[model samples]
Target chain A: MATEQKDETVGTGTLGKTMAVLEAVALAERPMRFTDILAVSGQPRGTLHRQLTHLVQEGLLELRADHVYLPGLRLLKLASASWARNEFRAVAAPFLEALHAQTGETVHLGVLRGREIIYLDKVESRQAVRMNSQIGNASPVYCTGVGKAALSTLDDAALEVILSGIEFRRFTPQTLVDRAALLGELEAVRRSGVAFDREEHEPGIRCVAAPVCDAARSLVAGISVTGPAYRVEQEKLEAWVPLVRQAAGGIKNELDARLGPQR
Target chain B: MATEQKDETVGTGTLGKTMAVLEAVALAERPMRFTDILAVSGQPRGTLHRQLTHLVQEGLLELRADHVYLPGLRLLKLASASWARNEFRAVAAPFLEALHAQTGETVHLGVLRGREIIYLDKVESRQAVRMNSQIGNASPVYCTGVGKAALSTLDDAALEVILSGIEFRRFTPQTLVDRAALLGELEAVRRSGVAFDREEHEPGIRCVAAPVCDAARSLVAGISVTGPAYRVEQEKLEAWVPLVRQAAGGIKNELDARLGPQR
Candidate 1:
């Protein structure tokens, strides 16, 4: 399967179109009318109509009595199957729990999903803070602690590709908007084996994060312990450097045990 | 789009098969090697190989260095989008939170997905008890409180389709192993506008549940108040009936506000 011809496609040729319509619906953020879908899609009316009908039959989308559409539960169920089999999540959860328990702050485990850091898991502290992140939320790779930590391990060529498309929307005063400045920060993060976000993303929130790598020394994911700026000051943030790194190492070792010795 | 030709497919005409392969991989529960996938898929070697390669290229699957395959992050991203746009989860969470707070017990919000009930959200009590259900986890619809509540709202024909495939793996003596018995239970639930699980699914755990319907008077999801047998006894379970129904009504009203009036 790995070496199979890349362009050979099978079954109904409309799969890509079907999926595109689904993605459009997912992005729409509301139950969509047929006319609304027609506006989003490039497909001709007859073609789009057929695709929607088959999709409804396949349980990928639901049709309301008023003829609006929402995502069907089958998508959720399939996603759960993906989550259940993801080894990084299973391997890092206990260590994440321990780190959260030790610090009594929000802990996050994230993996690089293309140019963005996709949050795989999160443990919200009993004392909650106002944060936009949840388990599946995505954040830019140059700002947040976990994102920077994971980004630090990427080679120059890989980093260049990611840097090309980044929209450096100035999130806050502390956010790094320059690529050179970000690369410099990554260099420091690579040296120290940890990264810090001093309210770079959200005001009054800070975190220290470290990259989690496999036995091959390839970066896989990142973890962070985060708290409010008032509570987790510069000193407290620095203090988490060793703890976050240790937790990262602990996760790496567990991965190594399951995946064999380091290359 | 709904009235387009039933079988008119575009692109590669192989979308359904590709999705089926993806589903098989999802159900495999482990990173699967080529031969492993071959065993699961009915497609010949050439066809299956092409499908896998294309899927990997599409970012629906990831091929590991070990030559095994796992779900790629794109699936997770799409699922997150589905979850984000799901008004049901958003409308039901606060009510679930209040229910947990009021009853000091575990709260679950699930939706009917085919024959199974998919748990979309859960609010764990501060004083937690051992429980098998979690967010994204699923349970059978025949015996569980939330499951039965949602099932009772389905029309007889649709109900028959779901009931036809149910495997009565009795978890307890109270589990409904026969169709007639389950139908009788559903009839009672319809009359009372609620459902109860007297440790039918899991011994020492019981719950009272009610369906949440949309403004169109169609079943949307179900909510339940669950607790240990020692604390939430038969009498206590009965006491929760009104509370669950009230919360269910709250969710319905909130949904109605967003979705407009009954058709």
Candidate 2:
């Protein structure tokens, strides 16, 4: 059935408005009341009410008896499907496991998303005090090892665009505080084929990371071995560089074989 | 700014159509081509094209250069937000860990969604060989330990509604083959305050499960300790019932404290 066409200029059609409602609910840290969503969406009372009803019916959002909205289980099902079918993450999974086994540290597979990195997969360490980075959480591209490793593979112009957009919010004392400092570090990372987070993002966490590329040599993602700063000191991080690079190359080769030269 | 209202009768407004498109992509095990989605959606080419374009723009779907559509990273972001804020799952995590520690087995926390149980949280056993149940995967209520445990908690009328809908696809000889057989088992489960899966869902895998309830004593979810049947024999499964029941009760108490009687 051909649904009625919506005004192109107004909220980018029905699909756009629907996504806006979903995002409004998803982005909030807590359950949002109907009025709270109304304040954020600025939609008409009846229209917003209808949209909320539709969203709840579709399982994209759940409306509680208290009249608050939260992201629903359907999102998890969809995300699971997304995660399972993602070729890069699937190809990198065993490599992540192997790297984790070798280093006995938490392994992360993160993809560059604009000026941030979104973790796609994680193989957590068995250690009780390991760094707790949740999958799907976004971290600033300027500070994270995975972020900088991905940045190292980008062309100068693409890197410049990303750099220009980044606000160097100092996360820790060791975080690179200026564009010049980060660029200099990127130069080093490019030469070494690895990136290091020296308690740069979190106070007690550090990591060694390397970028994974496809057959076309385009950066697809980055893999990192992260741990508590005290355990993964500078010497240990340096020692694990070869292992990290090997895992990244292994993922790249598997991705290349699976994707067969991205068109 | 007020947007134009969509036809209420057609496609449940724009949100419904959008979710349809998303579900079409998500339900597919592989990346879907434009034609594949079009075929599945039965929407006009122009309408489907616009929905796909809008979905990609909103980061809810990614259209690869190869012209295949996949569920997007935005789904993961939304799912993660949903997962983090989920009160029942959050309250059950530490208890799941404790349960896993006590039994040295894989622990799963799953919630009843319709007639299926969707795993919300999982703590994998350290053993190299264990039952691989991914979080977010659904299992039939008639064949799985968690499913039967949840069914044990429901009143007869509610249980009948669910039981009537279930098609007893026998996964194994052990699976409950009909509603009468399942009801008989559920009667035993209710008396015991635990349920068992004796390789009913998947051969060589078994679990002992108990239903977690809210402050109102309403069934909220189920917690299970699953392992390979060869290792977790019937004797062990029988022995773990008390531990599983305790974990379930702990989760119920915590959830009660967190949500305060669920309004």
Candidate 3:
């Protein structure tokens, strides 16, 4: 099956094209039509149709009666299996619970997924008007507490690569759309070991976040404490900063104890 | 590009074979060798190799430096994206938190995947000696409270089909190994609207479970309250049954309110 082309070349084989199609579908936040996929993936219509049909037949993609496609449960099973084996979620679960209990605010665990932050776990507060961040939700890196917390651990070069081609959309009035302002915030996050989201992603929501690291001291994910603007005042959020950082440290210690030696 | 074969008969195509390889890797629960896949899938070596190479090159399957294969992050991203859109996890998260708060026990949201129950979400209690059940962990259907809760919703024929081929190995002394005994237990579960684990899957641990159903009155998943045997005594578990059922019902209502009308 080896072609004469170099291995690193994109779209050099059927596998590469198949992967591009899957990526396009995965990145789509909703079920998409064939034309929409072609626009996103830039694949030829003939090739895209053939690959999509193959994917649908293989159970990797499911086509609705409306002729739109979405990812199937088979993929969900695989991801769930892998996340189960990873020790980070187990270590962070208790901390997430404690954060939820202490502040009576929603807590989230997020990790870097390309230029975005994908929430791995979340604990909702018992309050009447709470934020709605379900597990597996994703948000942009520049405006979210968890995203900034995780991104703060990256070196300048790595950060540049992530920031490089992304269209920085203004989510809210408080969103730091300017690259220099975001970079400044990241610097503060790196020094203080905390990040803040003051109605950046969603209006009237405030959050404080801290990064969790693996045995190698690599920033693997982040944990956050989030609440409504009226409930979580500036002083209140500042007071919870240490608590979030402590929980993140506890998670890091547990991961190191369990998986550090193995890695 | 249409072949003479019908779409259904195109199961022998390269894409079909590639998907089979990915599914086989997921089921194996560990990195697998080329021969292990061939043995499980019953595909000819040439066809298997071609598809495996395609998958590995495409980043759906990662090839270790030593040549073993495991599911990649690309597959994980796809699954997580699908999970983000799922309404079940959202509706169950709050109830899981309430159960954890009331019982000081680990609470789980699991759905039946074939003959196993795959945990979609968990709220771990903040206790020194807590029961260990991670999100995404799969447990056998006959011995787990969540499994029984879910299985109780199935009709007799569907239940029989699921129970027909399983080799029930006893994990603990209380586990039901005989098919007739398991069926008897399931009948009890159906009558009571609750399922009991009775230390069946692990020593000194017990759980009480209830089913979450869609508006169509079909079971979509189950929720469970698990803790140490001493804390969750039979009397205490009996006391918690109503609360568990209420939480399950509330979650079902939310699911129906969100997704039922659409389906």
Candidate 4:
């Protein structure tokens, strides 16, 4: 068994395995079958089945007629409540929508969670650029524009911790595999108040992103506008950078005004 | 205690209480303090506290710095996973978006869950009409457009089962309170292939809704276009009924194409 496998089973027992299996189902691009979940999760067949049964009983997962597992209605209800009150997101939505309207390109809002960045929300562009669906997907924090933008806001020590935790597996030739090079790029982002993907994560796709902060000067989230490299040319990128930064400023302003002197 | 209160406490023990308290938090429009959760849940303070603690440990709720409870990341992750696999909503998204763009009105997609209708996805209008944020909020099936549209597709036996479950508390003077009246309206909807909420749920709001059924002719979901009565006048409503039905047809076609001869 792998090193992480030992930890999932170490005294955590069924609860840990349950969570692991739930996550596998949640993270899959589609509803997962028992065999599909078994392939991704290292848990034994009997254990996984037991976990699925308990989860379904709790109204956390629904076993569909097709025998695939889907996130349950109860979970959807809770998420809807969260989405309603998600401060940064609620305030930033109109700005993101406007940006999408203005540029006719995809707009994304993501927040840092542990060492990875997870997309919290997105306004899809009619164009359907090379990027896959972004909502709820987590990506490495060293390559994507939103990731680097958030990194630009982190202090050196915090950045070091996050950078070291990343796998640094290169998805494209432009992906930064070295910590030093990534730090240098983040420095550029810090100075310019913007970050660019430069075909770092995927070919034929590029993005410009900026980090958002609250009244407390804490980096709360990042927003990006992305498009195909051919359509979003070098000069167009220069144009979009200021708009992305302005949107971050707008979100920060709304946060400050609505939150009323965050303590 | 009320009759429902006694039922919630019936043989279920702490597990039932835990779910009740968690639901109180989930249903709140904003993060709730202990007192807020207690006020709505009717659970004893001590029991509610213990349940909250256990839930926090289980990664279902996060006690925030301000001492209010919010849905935790785990819940959000699970919700996102569900959103991804919500086949009807996913397949109908482009059609809904197009309908919203063409009509310049808020479009709602909802699925029938038990006795209520739960909005699965929405294409928000720039107009910001009288509709309260609809996603995740389940509404009574007798007075709302989407609700009646879904009801129209159900067989008499299923419709009877659902109608008997409604609380029938009137929210507006126009709201349907009598089962006979609601059944008559559903009959009209069934014949017309669409339903209208003529300010029956909320004053000043009107919607034209249509049912989306799968290849099996079972009602899978509904879509509606809602606007203020002044803007979506009775005459204008006539024009929109066909459009809403067409959108429902589009969703049905998409669902059929995607599910591939649903076995």
Candidate 5:
């Protein structure tokens, strides 16, 4: 048992606070101590300890002989099992690798998280101008290629909710800040079965994206190919659209097969 | 909140019962109701609900709108993060694929789990004589190539503890059950840095494995290539020893760099 003082206040309910501590641990670059978690999560000592104890007993956290904590094997087992069953990753990894090999461009996989898009995976090209993205990195959902691909799957009500919560920030000259403009783009994405990020997230970079939907017709995730503006021109991107869409379709098909018709 | 009927006869602790419920859900292969968990875990309603509430709060489990329970995104996030950080997968995947491409044999990455060896990752070859060793599968630590590679890392006392716990059930003719004999073989493994399985766990399958050690010289994991016994004879396995060792070394170097010299 370990003890530490906590000064910062957290208001996201007891369960939410517990989740915050776990998230803090998960996001850490290394194993952490009780004090480190307290500092990062800003939760009171008593609350954090109680939650951690429960987590330890549940095997979600491992308490080493040195009293430092790390994510436990149980969490790893659960995660691996889930990932093994994930249709999206199974379908997309080979395709993404193929896309990278074919065009010498970086590939990305992402899913919506609140008003942001969380990157699930990325395959970097062996070229000099590599696209900068990392697993677990998050960016605004209204600008990135993967973001529009996912947004195109949602109904108007769900789309409205996401748009309402976001404080649209401009990253470059091409970023869409207005709700109407973004909605129009999403509509176009729905019609085209593809999405585009023409330097919307980062200047001098462009990406083409497509949606992966489960058998339930619900959007699960998105796949994108990104490269320099000079290499990935309008004509070149248009030519690759079918490939991207085919990859997404293949993933959806796999997901449906594995998950038994999704919903 | 999910609930279970308590068993007065069994003295399993609250945490243990909670783990049992989660394990039951995992083993069932689909979302389960409160009644289902109660039946499987054999815990009282009050205790089960409290445990489920805690687990759900921690994001280890999720309750559907219809009240069925399933593993949650938190599990996926933790697993993916750990897997991404795991050096064995990063280093071994390419080499394993290369081995498969060269020899048309199944390749495996395994680590010691208690007294067993669990496959962390695997790449199957296109050959018709395929083995059933899939990722997440487990085998006794004394019988398989990867198992012996991992077991060779333990000190005498730790080895004795593991040996003492084993039922020593023989799987095949080559399986080692005698403690003294196993110890001598492990000594050879430590000196030579390789382990072999001549159909010890499965008939008609032969494997050659090499130890992957971190910077601190502790065994992190093992990598093995398996093929039909007729195709992978003593002389051929001897030839493969260098390739397996080199792959293990490559993975160890990457692991050391990524995991910060390993504890």
Candidate 6:
């Protein structure tokens, strides 16, 4: 977790320290016990206990009868407000729906966050066999279609910085195993205005993606149409390239209109 | 807002002060300015500013170019984890889907918190028109179907506390005007084993709801099938009462099986 470095950045303030403890619980793969959180947060047992108690009292964390801490319902209330207030997601909604209707596949909208991509919104396929992506989860930028497409929109210096920091852990045989391979693929993505994930991120999932840019041509986010590799044949995936690109362009156009040309 | 009372509960601790500011931003109807947050949090300018800066840096709050604060992307990540870790929501998912399919309407699963109901999950209808309720948003317990249904499961003393705290803010003409009216309905709800929202929370929105209880017969949550009044006739909505009740029962059964009979 990047939380170790994040802890250092926050320094010694009580608020920052408390937040670090909260993040430890929030980001855990499962509900954490007191000792588990203490290990991750590296805070004194007494301090961590007090922080956890305060968090529970504030409804920021829920301590179940099972003696494990989980994210509280209040987090959802706060997140609902966050999701509703996000102008980018609001502008992209209809476009996402349109794309989902046209493709009959899952559609994802994600933005670059450091070396990872944070999914902002998604439209699930009506079909039973759909991609199992959840909104707000982070994925590697070096292998995923949406991530690489977003990367292709960055200036060279920014791209280089991210690229240098990337630690490519191969998920599938087709995964680009190094920065050089990813750099080469990004060149093709920039030229074609799209990116492809040929089971690079997962064993059976593939997608066609394109970056959405603002009026200034700066990357705002990326959109993708993902499906099972067996069902989404190479020909069918290629056919979706233009459709995905158009949807990305459409979102950008709408955002530009809403925010004005000067923005 | 209940935040002022909540702030008092947290005392003058730095962490509490910081969270109060974060909550002020999180619970705002719109993005809040620094002054707006300061007014609500009742902190010194420098302390509030420092807290805001710290929160922004930690990704708990985001500052826009226009100098307004909104809940940050990190909140979504945390809330997503919280949602995934919620055993109640996980157990109810398939039942919710079945109810949505059976009724051809929006399905909501919510748990009572103080005087409100926090929606845990939703299965939206495939119709051209749908309910605007988001998964994480809270609705007043006395007014919403799910909320009232859950409230029916609470003991008289527990129920009285929530009823006394309610402000009875009327959103529509059909809303229960006071505690006595709501208590009368809760008594009826206990007998019938279901609750109805007849354009109570919002004009034209109606639902039939049932409470889900644990093996020990304590309230776990509530489930409801909601739709526009025009699209859902009174006869059709009444017909869904059994289906909604069955879904709630099924969710409770599954929870009992998964968490073990002792739980």
Candidate number of the best TM-score: 6
The C-alpha RMSD in Å for every predicted model, in order, reads 6.2, 6.0, 7.7, 4.4, 6.8, 3.3
Per-residue lDDT tens digits of candidate 5, residues A118-215?
A: 67667763412211215446578899999999989988788888899778889999999889999899889999999999999899999999987664
User: Cα miss at B259, model 4 (Å)?
Assistant: 5.5
Residue B261 accuracy (lDDT) in model 1: 50
| Whole-model lDDT values for every prediction | 0.79, 0.81, 0.76, 0.76, 0.71, 0.81
lDDT tens per residue, model 6, A61-112: 8887778888788888888777767778888888888898899988899987
Question: Ten residues in a row with the worst lDDT in model 5 chain B?
Answer: B125-134
Per-residue accuracy of model 2 over A188-252 as CA lDDT, tens digit each: 99999999999999999999999986644434579999999877789999999999999998888
Per-prediction DockQ scores?
A: 0.36, 0.44, 0.25, 0.37, 0.23, 0.54
Each candidate's TM vs. the true structure?
Answer: 0.87, 0.89, 0.68, 0.81, 0.70, 0.91
Clash-forming residue pairs, model 3: none
TM-score computed on alpha carbons, candidate 3: 0.68
- lDDT of each residue in B1-263, candidate 2, tens digit only: 33243322245666677777887797697779999887777778999998888888777888776888888888887787787777777678888888988999888988887777888888865623211227667678889999999988888788888888787898998888987889999999999999999999999999999998664443457999999988988999999999999999888777667677555
Q: What tens digits encode model 4's per-residue C-alpha lDDT throughout B8-82? A: 333333444566677778767667999888777776788678778767766667786668887665666667667
lDDT of 1 by residue, A25-72 (tens): 865867799998987676679989888887776667888777988887
Candidate 3 overall lDDT versus native: 0.76
Candidate 2 wrong stretches, greater than 4 Å: A1-12, A127-133, A215-219, A261-263, B1-11, B127-133, B215-219, B261-263
- Candidate 3 deviant stretches above 4 angstroms: A1-71, A87-109, A120-135, A145-157, A183-198, A206-263, B1-77, B88-109, B121-134, B152-157, B187-195, B208-227, B235-263
- Chain A TM-score compared with the true chain A, each model in order: 0.84, 0.86, 0.85, 0.82, 0.71, 0.89
Error of 1 at B131 (Å): 12
Interface RMSD of 1: 4.8
Output the lDDT of residue A81, model 4: 72
Sorting all predicted structures by TM-score, with the top scorer first, yields 6, 2, 1, 4, 5, 3
